[model samples]
Target: MSRIEWERIGRERRRVSRWSGGTTAEIAIHPATSQYAARNFAWRVSTATVEAERTDFTPLDGFSRILMVLENELTLHHEGHGTYRLRPYEQNAFEGGWRTSSEGRATDFNLIYDSRLRARMSVLEVPGEAALVAAVGSLPCEEGEHWIHRIWYTAEGSVEAADAGGNALCRLDAGDALLFAVHRSHGEESWSLRNAASGRAVVIESVVFS
Candidate 1:
């Protein structure tokens, strides 16, 4: 099994729009033709700029959603679910079907996944000159399963991904992302995410298992 197959999604591919108060830049969507306007995607990832002071979130029934603030602060009020206060890098997962509204001027990262898949999202803060390791192994994999994807988004500063041998695999700057597809039969694999910037680097990491 050839592992470590990855793709670098540059800023150019991020389709951005400024026609609304909540301008969004779509990073990627599964199925290649999943329509955001039609809400028919298996999974989708993107960033949104919340310019309005108070914005009502669209109800997306039959989907699970995760939101993380990338800039400024945010407060989410999900009716029937409690309200959540989120700072930069902080996240809250809620049902997309909730009557949700928010108050904040911020930039945020989001993930929406259908019930057919299980997903997890987290943030990695790497101090200057330091590194964090991402390891995938047999624990999460069952007997010969596939369809696992590990995605990394550079939210702040710069980062470098290296293999166990310390050989550089990829370097990502802010607003850029990398996607890795690994088969469970590969047994195990790991990567060291290093802060290649002068200060610190923040990376949004997500794992989707189907």
Candidate 2:
């Protein structure tokens, strides 16, 4: 985990892996390690689908998942529970177990974190600026002992964020995500903006206390 690293998501990147019960999707593993499979909890980004008349999935022991619809609309049904609908860009949460059922189809982003770890998470919709005059000495360093992780997703227009060293860390379009981690003490850090889109940009930040 270093101060700043650029990330990009593209086709043929092999970011996806298939799951049990006949589900297909892509996955991006942060910290990209083989030990993660047996760890208490790990953050995984995935895109999954739900076909018509499909029902039941084993409850992930000590794990919870957050769903963000990326494509299509879907209606979810649970045994002894009610039905809920999610559209593109909308979000919802569901327990993974045999009780969950699905009808129709959808493609969604999943945030799977082990419940035993008690890690907290949240998603924020960042507002876009019309324009920004980026300078050479923008991103400064910070000094502290706390851990800070920042990620920006392209929801509207293009964005470029870098450190004071003039390294191009992120250049993203709509539906792209960038991850940043600061491992040591740092100073002031700044973000630069170029051509902006009308709609607001969205960012998802997760803090884990171990």
lDDT of 1 by residue, 28-78 (tens): 787568888777887888999999999899878999999999999999999
What lDDT tens digits, residue by residue, belong to model 2 across residues 37-91? 4643355555666654464555666666666666688667766766778787776
Report how far residue 190 has shifted in candidate 2, in Å.
4.1
In candidate 1, stretches whose alpha carbon ends up further than 4 angstroms from where it belongs are: 18-20, 137-145
Task: For model 2, state the Cα shift of residue 33 in Å.
Answer: 1.8
Residue 172, candidate 1: C-alpha displacement in angstroms: 0.3
Q: What TM-score does model 1 achieve against the real structure?
A: 0.90
Highest-lDDT candidate: 1
TM-score of each: 0.90, 0.64
lDDT of candidates 1 onward, in order: 0.83, 0.53
Q: Pick by TM-score: which candidate is best? A: 1
Whole-model lDDT, candidate 1? 0.83
